[model samples]
Target: MAKKNSNDNGKTFTTQQGLNSYIKGICDIMRRSNCAGALQYVPELSWLLFLKILDDTEQREAEEAEAVGDSFADSIPEPYRWRDWANPQGNRRLNLQMGQMGQFLPFVNEEVIPYLKSLKNKPQATPRQKIISEVISSVERVRIDTETNLLDILDKIHEIDYIDPTHIFPISQVYEGLLLKMGEKNNDGGQFFTPREVIRAMVKAITPQVGETIYDPCCGTGGFLAQSYEYIRDFLADDITPEQLKTIKLKTFYGREKENLIYPIALANLVLHGIDYPHLWHGNTLNREVIYGDLFQDAPPQFDIILTNPPFGGKEHRTVQAQFAYKTSATQVLFLQHVIDSLKPGGRCGIVLDEGVLFRTNENAFVQSKRKLLNDCNLWCIVSLPAGTFVAAGGGVKANILFFTKGKPTEKIWYYDLSDVKVTKRKPLMMNHFQEFLELLPNREDSERSWTVTREEIEAKNFDLKAVNLNTKVDEDKSTAKELLDFIEEKGKEVALTLSVLRKWER
Candidate 1:
């Protein structure tokens, strides 16, 4: 638990360490319960954290309304409210804890969850109520195995003060850390997450402004959209108006997510990041299928800027492929086509593409897609990411970041290579690694690591946009045959000695 210190005003504040410890304690209890994996625990935790924060926000709003002698309405009603049932100090929670042994669990499963899920179906549900409904839409019951564990988790979560200033950092950042666990190796969450450093670099290059709409067609847990919000908020901190702030918070960010599990997570994530309204569509982006689109109803047909890392190495059905201009089973390629068509004429995009999408010319779909990209957009820059860059996400494919603006054909392309820098799971990619790349990006400056390619050259090579470094020379091995044989013999002796020891141990 975080050690709480009382401020001069008598309000308690906790340090970042305290907040981290609290989250860790909650995860420990979750592991002991039913949600042992990131996939299981993250979704379960997202809803709980969301409700806790929402209740805090509403409580503050209600107090302000009372001070002004105005009416206040809560989106959640009665025992369904976190204060009513989840808060440790609340009378309802005290009664439940003091009642029949397992009563608390049944109330949550039968009454609370059902009432929350039914909010969207109400005759005149508010937008906030609808958002709440969609957030917990897939949650049939509490995932925590026992009442004791659930109650303990709630108590720890309650300690997190969302409205207080003492924490220094946004509580949303703590949630981002939890999302990172989902992207860790063997978690099966890489499909929904892009590395934060990569997202930061992309969002920086795109530099989305306050008035322009930003989008991600396949926004996993809403990382791109959330980071864009942070970037814009910080960038406009000095001169931004209240109306512009409102625009940025309520009307700027938009996205589409397909997974039943991930869609709600994306909503909760953006809300935590302070986006008052995240216009995210719940559906398959490629096929234009709508699972639920109430939040995205107000989104523009074309956005001013887009930043996304679409899923890699995914195969789509032909029926889905039939929707795109250049038909391909590869999900990335189809997404490229969709992004190109989805942008306004002068709109810009920053996208992460695997080497296959960049260099695979044999397939007509790949070649045609690249051709369309060059013809419709200014293919300005490509950053070749190092191998094992996505090893944490269980992906081993080499990848690159492509930045382009719609409405103009390609004249020349600037390429920056970070592939030479070795990336490993222990030493992951970071923002500082792109120092030289960003410095040179403004002018497309040439260096050993950076170079430019002309349109004519790309056409001659059938539009292979792979970042091939021309300045670096390959060092050829020139060991003598005798030396190689002696080295092999020494290794052979060591292997034989190890095997002999193993045989003796077996006996």
Candidate 2:
């Protein structure tokens, strides 16, 4: 019982499928425009959709308020609202008929954006107000010059039927899909996204409880935090109480991001998912002065659960490095220490780090970090991912998810090798793929990819957390490295092609 229709967008699709296809249609339009890549295209589309949704939400809120006789001040002014200008015929200032591009574009450019930009200057702006202002300031300019392209894209965006409750999840999927595409582009925007499947697996295995605080120190687009929320919400089923729901909404999830452009998207993403203006700080988590300084009420020093995929193998400035006692510029090492410090005594952590963190003795920083991790935490499991795990992020980096608990040192660490499966943009790793690992996790059962090594064995190995799949013969790294190189090379060619196709937008 699904609707079907042949349209210019593509083949016939059900409501959810059609909405998802509409998102791709917008991307196809952006691909032909001045937008250089998915990084540019995704954010532009996100803001437009966000505005439309905001407009719809406001209209509903206004109606409900009037029904209840409650006073409500609209977050956005009438002139800046989406309904005020997007429709040519309905717009009071645009006196134009349907199919006409009258003052819609101009109103967005001259009136709406300017109003958003000016809000930060107002005295005593709320956190939500500050976030809206931040979004407007960091988002890219509209690069689609042709009116036809602009209007066509609008047609696709307008297909998001906010009027129906059934459309909410599908519309959200449309937004998340666009973000995933941005991450897949492996450009600056790619930094905003972690592969969602990996995040879901981490959240599921860790299983955050209700009323417990969940946090992500380097929450790019809030993938881990959002997944954690979704995991708990579904797990509780109808058993979730009103007070518990309030706690989840107002206090459960917390995060911070350093990127200016990415931070706003993180806010928008979490807000869209029902956490009312989440407690995500827009600053470096490693910066003691910024993080420790009284900034946000939501920014806490410790957490019940920490889930994150921090940037890999990067160095901090010497000035920033001085903040940590470790006295090294290695970013991931510093983040590891921060996580350890940020967790409550019995708190759990699921973090992603490069393989070098486990075994690299060349630098004292890496060795020290591993030593600290082993000594202070019960390092339960390490899921060593496949080579192409992050191909969308431009390279094949061998990484692992470190699942641990504070207050107890690790006696025996469990390891799982998931490197056999090939993952790429076209073929992604799904949730079902993790079922095997999940089944074995609770009992610490031994299997081909799952095994246990005593802490004494780890200590003898100098805290080197490499491929510990002892039962089977480990393959050589040559093929994996070569495949990764080939993948990167192909990405480069795609970028070159994209440049050629979108060269006209460069001006």
Candidate 3:
């Protein structure tokens, strides 16, 4: 018989479905409590989940320390621990629940939240304590309206055991599902998340090693960094040394996020993904404003690999634009310049850029940025993604992935076009979509779907490096009027029959 986990309602669950259903139940409660959207609820859930995981991790550590007759000091002390306050069977929770009807919410808001938020201010705060403070920095108070709803959420969160091997998937993946909800259309979190498939392909192409520093200038929910960690861990497998593992977990990934709502979520997301120390600076990367740099202290001056999808189509202020060599209000153009300058000599980068950056020579900044990229890096490959690729994330812009290496001037550039391939919210761009591109990426081979453009040719067109597939045949519409009318009639009959059935069902 498999080990089972029981929720507060006495229902037992053991599989991913059970976990997902449990999470959905929590979300349903959150919805009724006014956290109706992912943007509203995910931030509230992130801190709760982070504390739960933190307490769980410390509990295991305490047990291990006892086994070795060593002392253990938890980063979160006393009543602030998740077990003390969040767990239903815990002494503090039982006391509060049994003593008064409405004490739990006040206690959490007044005592527990402030305590966690003040961890970094302590005279002798551990690194873990500092991390806990940073992760909950944006959380002012529990957003769930009623005490009952908040308690219910806590109960469900407590049931999630991160160390349980019986569960088929990692609990971290459950947090990823929450982040995915944030990225859904109209959630307004699409800006924080790139499609996971895109991040995976970029990480695979970059092939970041265990020791190589990987950074994301705009790491929304730390997806690129998390995926890179998984890639490196899987690449090394059993051959990985403890030192290398420590480096990967503690020092390998770094990022900067400006949004108050997103920075803490990024920390929690990366921590849930097993990054113990995600050296993320909470600040505006463009304007060089440092909101909090304690976690990012001692970070490398430059990185070995940068995988990012900088926010698309946002205009920066003059202060931000002034910081970049290429003065442009276009956010993506400034980010491109930052990525270029942040790369170490001979470093590689894989970045997602919109179509405007590729073909827009009207903007001097765009042309200058492209020129700098070509002059400073080996502009290896550009994969033109199809339209509606980001429809699930509510993005409608046509985008491309640019793969390049610094310390080498561009001679020629390979281009892989998937613009003809149709994608929608229902049908997203998958890893298999890049099958031919990945296979031909090594030698820069030319196929009907792939081509190359030389630097000289690009300069002739004033550096318009858009992937214009020369081999794609533009087929002429040769059907007669009668044929077209027949085709339309057939489709109209199908639609009429469907509507007629639907009308009968309505009755």
Candidate lDDT scores, in order, read 0.83, 0.72, 0.82
TM-score, per-candidate, Cα-based: 0.89, 0.84, 0.89
Clashes of each: 0, 1, 0
**What is the lDDT, from 0 to 100, of the residue 374 in candidate 1?**
96
On lDDT, who's better, 1 or 3?
A: 1
Q: What is the lDDT of candidate 2?
A: 0.72
lDDT of model 3, residue 395:
65
1-507, model 2: which lDDT tens digit per residue?
111111233223357777677677788898888776877787777677777666666677677777777866667666676665553323543553343665455655666787876775668766556656666667545667676677777666655556543455566666777777777676444345778788889998899999899988888888888777778878896899988888887788888888776877877777666665577776787874342211256556789999988786466787877777675676778899999999999999999886667766666776777888888999999998875667665444567899999989889899988877767766767788799999999998999888998888877877787866667665666667788897777556644533442332122
TM-score of 3: 0.89
Off by over 4 Å in 3: 1-15, 165-169, 185-188, 474-507
Query: Could you give me the TM-score of model 2 versus the true structure?
Result: 0.84
Worst 10 residues of 2 by lDDT: 1-10
Top candidate by lDDT: 1
Off by over 4 Å in 1: 1-14, 165-169, 185-187, 473-507
lDDT of 3 by residue, 237-356 (tens): 889998998999898999999988889999998888878899999898999889988888888889999999988667778888888888977888899999999999999999998777
